[model samples]
Target: MTKGGMESVELFTSEGKGRGLKAQKEFLPGDVIFAEPAYAAVVFDRTSTWATTTPWGATDLGRCGWKAAIQRGTWGCWLAVADQEPAVPRGAREPMASWLGLEREGSGLAEGCLVSIDDLQNHVESFSEEEKKELRVDVESFLEFWPPQSQQFGIQFISHIFGVISCNGFTLSDQRGLQAVGVGIFPNLCQANHDCWPNCTVIFNNGNHEAVRSMFHTQMRIELRALSKISAGEELSVSYVDFLSLSEERRRQLRKQYYFDCTCEHCQKRIKDDLMLAVKAGESKPSAEAVKEVVQLSKDTLEKINKARMEGLYHEVVKLCRECLKKQEAVLGDTNIYLLRILSIASEVLSYLQMFEEAADYAKRMVDGYLKLYHPNNAQLGMAVMRAGVTHWHAGLIEAGHGLICKAYAILLITHGPSHPITKDLEVMRVQTEMELRMFQQNEFMYYKMREAALKNQKIHVMPEPSNETSPSLFHKKE
Candidate 1:
């Protein structure tokens, strides 16, 4: 796992996995292995890609990991870039392009196209008969509304392109975690293979934490950063899916989606599976029957919570989460996915509703459980801590809030790196919290009033208007 003298990562062909990237230098947590801009970033343009008059009526096909739309957008990008002359002087991007295996010499999609969709695996054999049938139908549907040039690719070629997109397309999320904007193919980033518990994570760097960006920005790039210390000569791996699921479920998804049987140590050893699916709490184990019932109930409640959130039924979300949490707290372990899910939602909704005290309480639990589940450098844990900190600050627990914010900042420095926009924002929050905490320590009353005024204005924006009319007094004694 350790290479003594190598300086950087290099491309090495794997035994059965064709080609992959490997680190030649040791990477401490938060160290950047390399960065890659999308070989092709297809912005979601409704007008350009769609007929705009479907029965669905102007739907954003590109939003939220829609596969066909990603294909269409990618095909559109190919067409867009294919015919254009080099805007920059010739060979400007060649050296890095050559390093990442991007083609520069040839013309059109077949021969010197930067996109290697033609070479990428479609994983056709991984599909069952029903899934294969569905794929064909999707291909047919895609071709129906596409431009005339799309027809020239024919069913087979188009299907191949679709297969590659299915396999390799990274769903690009704007930093806010609000929505999926589009998909991009980062050829070099794809070189790192999948691991259930990966050493590295792909980060979308746009230089602004609060600003959501479309695909057009120059700063839109993916950085491969270490989540833990990676020794030199080790194969760089990233998790293709999230860590909420059990090893079995995660491996199932890996096989179906990425077409690889995950043999990662985490999957092989079933590491932390007990913690993830624990039904016991402090010498109190629920009966198997009760645990089974509670498990189903938790999933059902989570589904309802998601539905309510999508419908903007914030109050309903709160109610469902509260009920779910109550049931889960008794029967489920603190680290149970369902319980964690409910707590996460409850915290966010309560904070948004300006119920900061309750939000901070839920957030504190969420962060605690998450810390147990995730690596110390995990970004999700960092974000949870940041949210809890902000909630505590708003709730006027300035001391605790400042401590949490500082902790979050330290964690983010590893997961997101100091140069990252989110880390920069966390630094600002840390500084502000430190100053306020000092002020409060110096004179509690003055700082309390100022904090109250700030939190009050925030609540004013979020909360409903107060009733102006006063109630009639019983002492007035109208018969």
Candidate 2:
């Protein structure tokens, strides 16, 4: 596959997973796998009308609301307004209707709440009397603002949209990585299967400055990249759930939402390890009182650090983080989750303040901690390594920086691929560090040569004074 070009991948049937993309050729780490625009997207804002009354608090209800919003471009009372005046112009509505209808039909919705679209037709049919009654209230509240377009059609439409959103929506976050701003439906990205240890990741890019002037005016695209080296015929997978949690927790979450039992190699190993740990815990667990004390202390420290950060007291933030780290380390050691969390905070804050050396220290620690706890090719490890490399570079540790960057590049090449902005940024750093190292060596060599010549000239130009016994050479020459 060509660098920064189309990836060697194709869609195929994934075992256990309905459909998935597979690599068609060998992929190196940091290669761009593929880029695609979202099929449909909506920016999330808490202040929006639907945000006020939509039953999105419940997972199922939220999924339903997302689908309705995406499909009709409005929810609740707005749907009624659209029905009457048709907010979508005639020319636009036709195409939208065609797309939504096609998507809805193909979404595999079924009538039961078993997390599949295939059972959507029997959804109401299978509902218990209590469930049906509750659903009626939800549907009525959803339509409270809308004029009656057609009760039967509205009910069916809402149900189908709910199933589709539950199955397809992806959380959208802004560039800042602060919080999720919205949810979107990316048809192509939705095709990739789930793996506890995913080999690919999806990133969203909102267009340039002018484009971001208005939220609605901006165009967003989702990019998919290889997280690790994927051999030809290897299935490309992304994590659908947080993989940081233990295998049991991850499996439980996936089963609850996606309705699938994960039998992936990572999950299997984690499950086995967790079971073993549990057995050992029974034999040599810590004292309950001691554990409680440590937990409470950690919690209090974390709270204080968060408050300081919110108040923009960065110095306090760093100080608190360090204190927390010390306490956690003394009690739980470097690999403990709490210690790792504090280390991450310290690294980020220090980097933000341009304290590169200090940041590098914390980042290095984070990398080491992640390495000890996570898989070799884990995305978090890649991120920590990258941070360490960048900070080291900024701190003038050119060789260390270069080596760390290369290491990070190798790992990221497999997990994030080359086309990703992150990988691209790291490449820039790698080249820069290489150039800096060369210049530094050249300057050092020139300085040493100049010093050597200066010393030799001093020896040659200086004449030895006559010895005391021969000082009167002119008068004692005869003697």
Candidate 3:
């Protein structure tokens, strides 16, 4: 199972899912397993939907446009670019099957759309009517020009990408003209899977070019094993909470869109199961008593917060978060996931507060908790650590800050490699920190010497005019 720098676990191979990394020992829920940064990424969206066709926007159309791009590099075994002929330019078309959207085949993909690994990995089966309508129109239009395969050895690319989007596509934040900075987390992360009561998470670092992180919980280390059992030889599995819906409708929608099945205990039982688990385990359960106790306060606080935010009372929003934390702690208890909401709010509030130290501390704790609940190497946890370091630097705790930043930089280098944006930033910051520390030390020493001379009645001296080098006293007036 030794691959890359990691000593443990067999990774999935092209010959079949390899007997992936098996845990030699038990790992807690928030323990870190492994993380690899995306080698390279290509962004696409609604306007650029049918990859092979037209409308290659600002994004670089690498190698041979859409389908050919995937085959550029080998990204582990079992994962490969959907098979398609090279797309020649307009007047120079290749004698190949129509490659545009989704298509069916015997065992493998007869024809599949060119998509980012993450998009393909998380494909689902259901979509909203509006999305379906749009997808249908797009597919029909594409098929009108590029028909399907008729023979047994035939290959036809349909429009399943739009269908996939229709079912479970993500809404990217609108970016004007500029390439979207931080959308599209890597697809490899998708294989980690989902859970109703998940023990791992992925998060994006909004500040650092939306760098992704996978954090492990430091506080409660041992509890992680329950979510995933690592035998001497097994693939590490983390919880994916998005697919934890109990309703068949929700499950169907997720499956249709994200393309994964729900076998997690929470999804199997639905709300009733979650409710029972919460009650029996003495954890925070969604019940009449719990809701009744905190509902009013939560409602009132949220209302005020909304009003305050609308009025731009940033401080007031911070106050509300503090109150939320207190109330939630009183009612839901400290370890409850509900507090995550409060912590998230607090992190945002403190980030806005411009109190970097406080903000970083909150971020650190939240990240730690996320790692505990999910996995240490979870993207969300990594983001938290990154945020904490940035915030610490901003807060003037440069020494403390350097330590945190270094940790993030080291991890990012391993997962994302040395060329990632965050890794570069970390290196830059390291240099900057060294310079700052040197300046700070020099200034401190000078200040101390000046003060010492002043207290001792010794005249503070400066360089004399041109003749001062060998002069008896630089501060002496010519007599």
Every candidate's lDDT: 0.63, 0.55, 0.40
lDDT of 3: 0.40
How does residue 247 of candidate 1 score in lDDT?
91
Candidate 2 residue-wise lDDT at 218: 31
Whichever of 1 and 2 has more lDDT, that candidate is 1
User: How many residue pairs collide in each prediction?
Assistant: 0, 29, 47
Q: How many backbone clashes does candidate 3 have?
A: 47
Candidate 3 lDDT, 388-414, residue by residue in tens: 776766666666667777766655543
Candidate no. 3 TM-score: 0.48
List model 2 lDDT by residue over 1-479, tens digit each: 34432345676778776667778887755456666544344442434211211222211112122223332322101111121321322112111222343344444432211223332222344444765565555455545533354233546666444444445666655442334544455555666788877777666544333222132333356666666677989888887765556678779867655657898988887733332122113445556565556657777887887777767777888898877666555455455556666777787778777677887888887777677666677665776787788778766666787888998887766665565566777788888777767766779676445546656686433222211110110000000
Residue-by-residue lDDT tens digits, candidate 1, 20-51 = 77888778877777766555544333232311
Q: Against the true structure, whose lDDT is highest?
A: 1
Question: Lowest summed lDDT over 10 consecutive residues: which window, candidate 1?
Answer: 470-479
